[model samples]
Target: MFWLLFTLFMVACFSAGATGGLFPPGAWYRGLNKPVWTPPDWVFPVTWITLYICMSVAGARVALAEGNGIAMAFWSIQIALNALWTPVFFGLQKIRLGLAVIGALWVAVLLGMIALWEVDTLAGMLFAPYLLWVTIAAALNASVWKLNPEQAA
Candidate 1:
């Protein structure tokens, strides 16, 4: 049951991550005047991979607990929002929309974290790093939007 639940959650994370492959940040992103705090290019994949593992483990733990209905729902919402941000931002070249999407993602992650905590402390703990990453991502998205008004959509 643990493996099965882990597989399902991992698949959900992987599906959301596939958007990155579909709409990669190419020359446009590279050319942007990013803030000094922007992370190096290599940081994204590594951070996401680690977050995915934590997210999947969190979900798996929650799935095993009783009365995890709300937590699971929040989990689904966060993953869906995660899948949307890439396409809207990179594919559509809409930095403003990206900010909105990421903002919602941040909220969903927060709610998911809280709800997961109620069900399983370990599951909630796993989301702490994910929330931190999303905080950074949201700041990055907002910074990019502010820095590149001409590119706003």
Candidate 2:
């Protein structure tokens, strides 16, 4: 059961990380007017991988704890919101919608973190980076929306 659970956790993290590819090529990203402090493109994949792993570990911890069904449900919702952002922004090229989704994702992640905290502090801590990353992503998404108002929708 432990191995099965671990496998499921890994699959969730991997799938979420890889969802970036659902977007158009990085070329489209390059064309955007990014913030001055935007990290180099290569940094994104590595950061997201680490963040996703942390998120998965946190989620798995909550799942392993007693009476975590509600926590798990909220966590699942946050993950789904996370997964949808990349496609909405890059795939569909809907920056405004994506920004809105990302904002909601931030709130959902916070709710998930709170729920996980009830089960395990370490689980909540694991989501810290995830929360921070999404906060930054939200800002970036908003910046994109601002920079290209015409393409926002």
Candidate 3:
């Protein structure tokens, strides 16, 4: 049962991740003016893969907990937002809209982490890195939008 739940969560996370492949950051993103603090391109795949595994583990753990409705809901929200951002920013080149999506994602991740913590300590701990990564991603999205006001408009 635990393995099945984990697999289901993994599927969800990876499905969200697939959006990146579908809407890869090509020439447009490379041409954008990014902050000096922007992570190297290689860091993205590595970090996301790690985060996905952790998220899957967290979700699976929380799913089996006594009271996880809110946490699960938040998890679902975050993943959907996660899937939306790549297409908005990379595919449609809507940097401003991407920022909005990521901003909402940040809130959902934070609330989900807290909710998960209430149910299971390890599950919550698993989300810590995900929250941190999302913080960086949101800041990066905002920074990109600010630096490229022309594109943002």
Candidate 4:
């Protein structure tokens, strides 16, 4: 049951992550003036893979536990927001909207972490890296928006 739930959660994470393929960061993103801190292209997929595994473990732990309504809901929220950002930013080419979405994602991750921690310590521990990644992502998104004010519409 735990493995099944973990697989399900990983599927959800991958589903959300699929947006990257759907909307690859092509010429537009390449042309943008990114901060020096921007990670090399290779880092993204690797980072996401690690984060997803941790997230799946966290979610699986929470799901199998009884009375996990709030944690589950937060988990759901973070995933939804995660799925939304790529389409809005890379698909629609809305930098400002991406910032908003990523901002919300950060909050959802934080709240989700806290909520998950209340239920299980290991689950919360698993989520910690996700929050940190989102923080970095949010900063990156913000920096992009700042550097490319012309693209904010």
TM-scores for all candidates?
0.98, 0.93, 0.98, 0.98
Off by over 4 Å in 3: none
Candidate 4 wrongly placed segments (more than 4 Å)? none
Q: Among these predicted structures, which one has the highest TM-score? A: 4
Winner by lDDT: 4
Lowest lDDT 10-mer window, candidate 4? 144-153
- Candidate 3 — which pairs collide? none
Q: Lowest-lDDT window of 10 residues in candidate 1?
A: 144-153
TM-score of 3: 0.98
Candidate number that wins on TM-score, 1 or 4: 4
Quote the positional error of residue 116 for candidate 2 in Å.
0.5
Off by over 4 Å in 2: none
- C-alpha lDDT (0 to 100) for residue 110 of candidate 1: 99
Task: Write out the backbone clash pairs for model 4.
Answer: none
Q: Write the per-residue lDDT of candidate 1 for residues 11-92, one digit (tens) a residue.
A: 9999999999999999888888789999998999999999999999999999999999999999999999999999998899
Model 3 residue 38 CA deviation (Å) reads: 1.2
Candidate 3 versus truth, CA RMSD in Å, comes to 0.7
RMSD of each: 0.8, 1.4, 0.7, 0.7
